[model samples]
Target: MSIEEPMRKTEQEIMPARASQITKPLGYDIYPYYSLGDNKIFNGYSSLCDFIIEQKTVVIDGYVGVYWNKLITALKEDLIDRGYALNLIESKNYLKSQAQLNEMIAPFLGTEGSVWGTKTTLTLADYFNMPALTEIEKSTSADINIITGCGASLSDWKAALIYVDLPKNEIQHRMSAGSICNLGLDLQKEQTEMYKCFYFVDWVVLNNHKKALINDIDIFVDAQWEDSINWAYGKDIRKGLEKMSSSVFRARPWFAPGAWGGQWMKEHMPQLDRNEVNYAWSFELIAPENGIVFESSSFLLEVSFDALMFAQNKNVLGVHAAKFGDEFPIRFDFLDTFDGGNLSIQCHPSLKYIQREFGENITQDETYYILDCKDDAKVYLGFQDNINPTEFRDTLEKSNLYNEEIDIEKYVQVHQAKKHDLFLIPNGTVHSAGAENLVLEISATPYIFTFKMYDWVRLDLNGKPRPINIDHAFKNLDFNRKGATVKQELIIKPSILFEDNDFICYHLPTHKEHFYDVHRLEFEAEVEVETNNVCHVLMLVEGAAITVESADGAIMTFPFAETFVIPAAAGSYKMINKGSERAKVIKAFLK
Candidate 1:
């Protein structure tokens, strides 16, 4: 496929250089990776050279590959490359091994283990001392400098710096290592080893820094501003680059969740400070160095993710992208069957269907993390003791167990789900987490691609029967495996606990592919906050927090806590306790 045209910010909106300022250019690099057949291909241009020639005014039009090189060459020969200079980047021979390929490419990436700030430098430091020499930048006063393209998914794209773009009426998701698509994502997930950039944590994003720093855009970035609820006093705050933020305040406090938004604000509100207008964003938290703050009692800084996204972007950018997140989100999903969705009768389609049509891959694996239930949640997993795919389909069709127009019983055996249970359901498994209970769903795509067997004839949210993909699913459902799930328990250390007046927290990395570190916290403050990750999403089952911060340091504290969210690029910030007792919260890394 041709490179998607680069989305460009209007030039007229860009700040003009001072008449007396030097017009020199700077340079950097951007690498693009694609695959051909089972083989992998790598290419990039003199990112440094291009930056120099593009000078101060440039559009990140497209990637420079074999074809792009020709365009650059033509531009250079035509003399239109005047302001935009580009040096060619050499290509290395393609290696035969995947491990070796990663090795060769790793060096060009952001420093590994570098502590990319996930919150306002000022605030994060106040609560947790530098775990390592960390990088913090102020969203306001910090000079803009670099720009580069970051690979989607994995880790870097999540916690550190994620790009924000509105969703089009249609989206073309890359599939099978950029090799093929149309294989409906449900089936393709197995063929492609797609992984998501863990969404809840800040570390993954920090590791995936690939873009150049830009100074022209003065928008403040902070994790705390995602909600109107405040953070604990001195919650993790961030500053840009090296400068300590001189101001802290909320950019958007009116965007908290709960239906009582207006009534809540009317009671615990403070007059808006015009001096902080230019420096405020709905989500960027700012609190001045002197300690003065601005906020409200009804903000929802920490609430359901979709609620926060709608509130923040709509108020600030005046645009609405779904709950997909500020820029990109690690949308891993999981499917479990039992009585919840008809299980025994349904199945998934095979690899061929996924690759040719569904456009799905790696991120689709289903894992079950059970919370509670009756004698544990009984699930329909795998094929019944001895049934093969052929027999299973026959039983389903014969028993009238497979019908979209009428309810049918999926005769697959049901298993139990205890706390912390782990069930890896591969495709073709007519299994589902069938018990009614609280369970954490994990996977790559946020979709329900089930070939339902029976739903007890339950109507969908729209009061319509949910259609079943019998033909496609039966082909993919795995018949080789069956029975109950397994669990691997780890000890919870005392060190992971964090409790205070504003919140509680716990973290553990270095456990698995650095996939994630669990975090749990609670808060009730009107503090400004910022981070370097896709930001944090706090599920508020209990208390609340109001976030308050500004690019120039205006503290925008909400009176109450609702679920809240944080973005990766957020700069300086803080969270102030506004209620009685400590509010509880949990933070998960989306690495």
Candidate 2:
């Protein structure tokens, strides 16, 4: 098939009759927020200034991508109008020069041609001139001494600290629009370079800084909006996090369009923008890129997911806390290729390679759970029986360089895909989901290390040739996983683990390389489950809706296609089907 040719409509293109029964709005909440109870969430510059004027000394620190100039200008105007003298100390003045920062981070950023980079070991403090900050801390003379910027807390001033947080998705949006630059840098680069900096250097430093400051913050601000802001007391946010740690919660999901995007999400998800060509990916719960939202009456505030982990890693992760720390070990996302092109033929880095090359603690071990697919849908996986490494590499390289077609089936195995089937893809295995499939990608948290070997001679959405990592793919591809071995080891078969009159639990075994296991609980009425001291990540795959009642009797309704979490501290819970049909929920937990 030519890359530019339109895809033929398949049975999967027709929405299922059951899909009409899903009358509920998009199960994925774009603004999912937790209640702040009686605590008030302040809004607007006037309210912010009203609180700030009362404090003697204040430090307004924020994440990268926040509009520091706009925030400072609004605060100054509001505070001055209220007759308060302000001594503003901008933290950017104390930052190391851009040249110095670039030199320091260059080693972590691989090269101009590659997208991969090593995680940075540098801290926010390392970007500032500590002596200058110390001198400024001693010279605070105005009535309200305020220090503000990305690392304003580094001033060491005994002040009421307010952290302004922007969600990761919003940061990426701002980066794409060329509205923001990396921390300590004044100029914005191309979107890819900026994203590389964020993934490897900027986010790493700021996340560590945020973790260190979590305990001391007095207020938390949501700076996602341009004209308004929502903020709550830090203690109140902490209390909300504590409540969530011991109960059930869902991270707000965001969707994006891609070159090989599909129409599944655009058609089924009513709230999505249909004007886009297609929806390619939904970030269901990729911890590093997702955020938890909190609400107080009509107002909403959001904080990065790591804030919850920093505050209560033990309660959220239970026994696994010691090993994983604040890092959420598992990730859930949606890859919709229904009526779309095939995903790039790719492989992920092995455990040792990921750790050594990228400084990630875990490899991108993955599994594709076929949520929905057409009758003719397929998945490219493993290798052919007589695969030649040299020939395969040469063909892929020549195809990329000459826009020539290579018979992918000659080098890779293709398997028929069906609904509810799970395919294990441990690192080092070559894999790709073919067209006409809505794949639920469950994997380890490290998601950005894909090494693409072939892309079917297609250009990206930007009209540019996508990066092909034939060399990296060759190093990581496991040639031994060929033909019969691929079917024997990678295609998982489910077995009934437990059964009763109302419910049955089926175990879908994962690869040994995966530290997590999967269970599908199908129930007609209600099913009781135990956390067993390990957190559970779940998605309602089969039914329209189900109610999850935690041990404390707190209940939350999750519609079909919604992803949620049950913290380990929740102990036991019950899943009650709220729809006419039986409910099938996928549960992933630490092995």
Highest TM-score among the candidates is held by which one?
A: 2
Candidate 2 residues 519-561, lDDT tens each?
A: 9999999988999899999999998889999997778888888
lDDT of each: 0.30, 0.87
TM-score of every model versus the real structure = 0.35, 0.95
Tell me, by lDDT, which candidate is best: 2
Residue 196 C-alpha lDDT in model 1: 19
Q: 266 in model 1: Cα distance from truth in Å?
A: 24
Query: CA shift at 357, candidate 1, in angstroms?
Result: 3.1
Compose the digit string of candidate 1's lDDT tens values, residues 1-591: 333433221111111111112232221000001111121111122332333243432222111111232333443443334442333221111112445433432332223432111111111112111222122221232222122211211111112221221111001122312322211111222211221111111112221121222222121111111111122111111111111112221122221111101121112222222222121011111100001121113111121122122224322212112333332233321122222332334544444554334333322334344433446456555544555666655644543443333322234665566644444444455655553433344323313345665444455433544444455566666554553322111222224464555444554321231233445444555433344433443333233344445454444333332223344334434665544665434333455
The alpha-carbon RMSD values of the candidates against the true structure, listed in the order shown, are 19.1, 6.2
Please, what's the RMSD in Å of model 1? 19.1
